[model samples]
Target chain A: MFLNMKTAVAAIALSAMAGSAFARDLVINFDDLNPGPKKGFDDAVALFQKENPDINVIVNINDREAHKTAIRNFLTAEAPDVTSWYPGNRMAPFVDAGLFQPVDDVWEENGFNDDLAAIKPTMSRDGKIWGVPYSYYQWGIYYRKDIFDLLELEEPQTWDELLAACGKMKENGVTPFTIGTKFLWTAAGVFDYLNLRTNGYDVHNALTAGEIKYTDPRIRATFSNWETLINECGFVDNHASMSWQDAIAPFANGDAAMYVMGNFSVDGYKNAGLTEEQIDFMPFPTIDASIPGAEEAPADAFFIPTNAKNVEDAKKFLAFVARPDVQTQWNKTIGQLPINSKADISDDKFIQEGFALLNGASGLAQFFDRDAPAEMAKAGMEGFQEFMLDPSKVDAILERLDTVQAEVYK
Target chain B: MTHAAVPDTTASARPSWVKRNKLAIAPWIFLIPALIFFAIYVVIPIFQSLWLSLYEWNGLYSADGESTATWVGFQNYAKLWDDPNFWTSLRNNLAWLILFMLAVPLGLFIALFLNQTVPGMRFYKSMFFFPFVISQVVVGLIFGWFYNPDFGVVGTLWKAVFCEETTNILGNVTFTCSRPAPDILSSPEWATYGIIAAGLWPQIAYCMILYLTGLNNVAADQIEAARLDGAKGWKMLWYVVVPQLKPATFIAIVVTVIGALRSFDMIAIMTQGGPFGSTNVLSHYMYEVAISEYGERYGYGSSVATVLFGIMLIFISYFLWQMYQDEKGGR
Candidate 1:
């Protein structure tokens, strides 16, 4: 009787194992837990699960900062089927370590070759596409429309025009631009625009790639223009003490007229009690006018880890995220522009403005921090903050950056 | 035939070796679990970190479970020597160590004041210890806002003295100061001191509680004897009370030294070693170089940790030696 009971237990356990094998588990790790992004991700997952009902989808959402550090450990120790990460040099280390698997086949099969063409170059490394981009947003000058109207200033189109506007605003007892460099990246946004405008896209790429020294004449020219902006435009005082969110106060209160920021800051302005009518977006004004304008648009993407248990389902999810209809619904909920060119955009004024700005741009940079290696980026941003605080120290700051660049890229 | 009887004879002879050495073996038996734990968690990591400091790694591993670290002996240390930021961090650490010592004397004073038998002495004691009960992160955030130059306590005070509020062109009220208010956290010169002041708040409370317990143990007869011999106030404190409070003072100093060395949380919450990395101590700098969003230099970060360990080693060894001497004297 005891022997018969043991056999019965073994049969039941084998059947249970077989039952779970039929409905495969696909685990996805997401970074952002903010309301809008979370909703977008949840909606996309729901749609995927509805179509692939045989697969059991398990989603783990983490705080973005925590996810960044956790990705290194989890990718190796307990790999997820799909994980959210960034594109470009930011993802280079993981790709080099053979932790992230190439999804070139996914891209080819889905015709992302054409739909996600804008971010194709960034997503590809080592002659293979590493991930699929879902959404990206443009970086430009976000200004207070009411403040501009009160000052009777038209959007500046040229370097001289911008300087003249700055002078007029300063004379009216208003700071022309407000920035907080406490976290350091905000200053890099300003630097990327200035460099891209002064020396063009190729120079920006070369500088970040460490192919050119920071003390090179072209880069020095960029610094000269930045110095000119600081001396004349005069960003809000004590900017070094404020975070990007804290800097919004001066702009909202009309003490400052403009901000060099990304599209994501719209929600921040709204939360600070400013209405849509009070604000407007403008492409960073032309500095040289000879160089075609290159705008900053950092993309967020998803990749399959090498140790993933369900490669088939992870690829399915990546392709689903790249679909035009799926991307349209996702980016719409998140207030961002979809990676799929065929995706429909929101009718919101700022979204429309951003879409138009990116559509007409000659090139798109993945921002200073994203384009550059992490070590170089940290030192470079600190130098930019220092220069902003004391423009007279430009020479010393550039020299210091040259030393770091040599050490980092080595 | 004799071998069969030998086993029974040895078992009964001399209580066996283990039974004879019971006093020596029993303590080790009790300590085996803790020693194993300490070896795994504490002792192993120190040597591992030291070994790791000689390599170049980005804190990643290959899919095959091999470390992605490359051996680059002493290169990281040589680089640290040439790096200006390292010097700045070291200087800031020195400043923290010196300023943090003030907590000991200040704590003693507060403990003395609270030790008197007033009407609501227990309530007053709890209130004095309240800062210690709260988390360090909260203290950091409170001080971060307190030092803000726009709407914080310092800013409001500055505005009241030097500025007038007026409506701007877009009809929003703002200040127009004759001279701008001080931005302490933004200025590289002052930011470190601002954070240190915040760290000292809770640390002082901690030291105060330690001394309060010590004060409870102070013999009333000894104090009376000192008083009858013309000892009072500073004389009483220095001659009679302080010698009795040696144990508390030693612990307070040790904790304060460690607290100064690990001054990461306040700087992280307050400025994140910002305004051009002026306020970094070694601990925060090591973390920034290893684990922060931009930092992945594990080998380099380990070298920084090694240097920090070296500094801490000096204090730790001195403390241990002092304890050893006290134990010997007691015997």
Candidate 2:
């Protein structure tokens, strides 16, 4: 009886040793709890679990807006192993505070430098890559195809052509653009596209970095072009009261024909009962022929917090997310473009069009709000809305923006 | 018995203290819990915000895990002086305070009308009080839809009156109005008034209920006596009914003033201080600066809060003094 008990005890000890070898737990805090993004995130987590069966994954999803505030509290106190955040200056403050871990090792191991070259500059600060970008989408003008066809108008390629098209549309009793600046960021999309088209990528960067003033002649030129757009290409009436979703009403009803928006708005248009044939994407018209074509493409990425308990697992998850196949599947599910250059894009027309537009661009800007500091972006977007409402306030708006820029950067 | 009797001396001594100070100490003993909660939740935070106003913090931590607060004495106040948004918010706040007072007279008028006996009168009174039961967020949303320029009631009315069906370059059916319809929530000049109107819907209901209760307690004999003395209609209401309803009027004014100052949630839900920050009040402006998605300028926000607090202090102190005098006279 003693010999049998000893053998049973030995067997239990051996199994416990085996269990200890693979004991690993990873926690991920994702921001978007919306249906599409949530499903995509769950699928990714499920796939990760299937690959590493022994590792346990804890996924905590939060509403996107609430996450914005909760992140400040969570990052300092009880950080997850990995958390989703934006790239560029949005991550700069956290990176500077050493809350986010530098994932250069993961990038090097996964050969992300070549694949994510387009977004590398945004993800890097102080010579270190802070996060792994999974998906990004291009911003452009989504216009009514039926309107263009009826007017016998081809897509405008230059500033003058766009203006002429706007004039013609106006004569036909259709507003050229529909924007809801109630949330303030929609106005910034217009400002970013104009600035990127008028000044090259360098000037745009310099302005957002606060190396140049808003009153600079280059920025003023951008605003002047914006003034022309506001005057010639009139937006929907009472736009400041409508949300981005609410603005879709006028567009869907054909009261407005064009919108300066992102690829995500395609789904919104579709959900608003607009058909696939009714909508088409075009790059923002060029203002200066000498300036190269650069586009605004905001990226969503995941980062490891410095206080993460499972650093190795977080790095592994990031590397897995960087895989071309994983990125392709994730972006396809969410209807956005994968950051991986080698990733396969679906044949959806808008996605195909956005891919081509971003690939051919000289550089990618992360939109005005993402590229600029949060404080500066807020004031800047408000100024843009003010300018859109009353073009005559351009000088005063620029002066105010300059003052805010000085204060923010200092 | 000798071994068990230990603390009877202390127990006996405690009864003398209790007997001598029971009147003075009993009320305080009953009040300690409430006073503790009041100090913790209310009194402490006011001073905390005041202290926080002198420092610049991003609501984040430094690399060393310390709070990222840098002392900047009156710089935030100095900045507030130059901020155009501040002046706009202050002006809107004043407008709200003045306009929201209309609820008092309107509520009293409704209360007087509903004071009469009629069939299903309880239902009517409850219906009139319905706006008070619904939350401000819901009211803002309902009003938001009511003011929508697309499918809203006002929009539909305007369309029927002025719009003509037209096909555009898009080859789709659309309506072109003779003139742009009034979109109160979107217009900078009109947004504050629109929100104030929505707010007053509930405020009026609240004041109405207050007056309704006061009307229930009115001396019918005295009212009849005034009527016998030839008081009628406006004179009867002004001299007899209104004079008797002074308590209700005072309470209504006090609550209306407080509601006007605490007009943050309505503005937050409705326009978010939008239409170029023209709808901002001090509270919403403070939130926009300190805690909103923009960025945490804690010092700047706290300074705004400090200014708001300073303004409220003047009225509150006067209110407290009045209450103190009333209490002394009653005693």
Candidate that scores best on DockQ: 1
Error of 1 at A56 (Å): 3.9
Worst 10-residue lDDT window for candidate 1 chain B reads B8-17
Q: What tens-digit string does per-residue lDDT give for candidate 1 at A352-395?
A: 98998888877889999999999999999999999998999988
Supply the TM-score for candidate 1. Answer: 0.94
Q: In terms of TM-score, how similar is model 2 to the real structure? A: 0.94
lDDT of 2 by residue, A1-410 (tens): 35324433543354344454337768788889788897888788778776776666777778899788888988888888999999989998788778898999998988999998989999999999999988999999999998888778899999999999999999888898999988999999999999999998999999999999999999999999988888898899888878899899889988899999999999899999999999999999999999999999999999999989999999999999988999989988999999899999988999999999989988999988889998899889888888888989999999999999889999
Instruction: State the fnat of model 1.
Output: 0.84
Error of 2 at B172 (Å): 3.7
Which CAPRI quality tier does the interface of model 2 achieve?
medium
Docking class for model 1 is medium
Model-by-model lDDT, in order? 0.92, 0.89
What does candidate 1's lDDT look like per residue over B1-331, in tens digits?
Answer: 8989998888888487888999999999999999999999999999999999999999999988889999999999999999889999999999999999999999999999999998999999999899889999999999999999998999999999999988777777888999999999999889999999999999999999999999999999999998889999898999899999999999999999999999999999999998788999999999999989899999999999999999999999999999999999999
The local lDDT score (0 to 100) that residue B173 gets in candidate 1 is: 89
> What TM-score would chain A of each candidate receive against the reference chain A?
0.94, 0.94
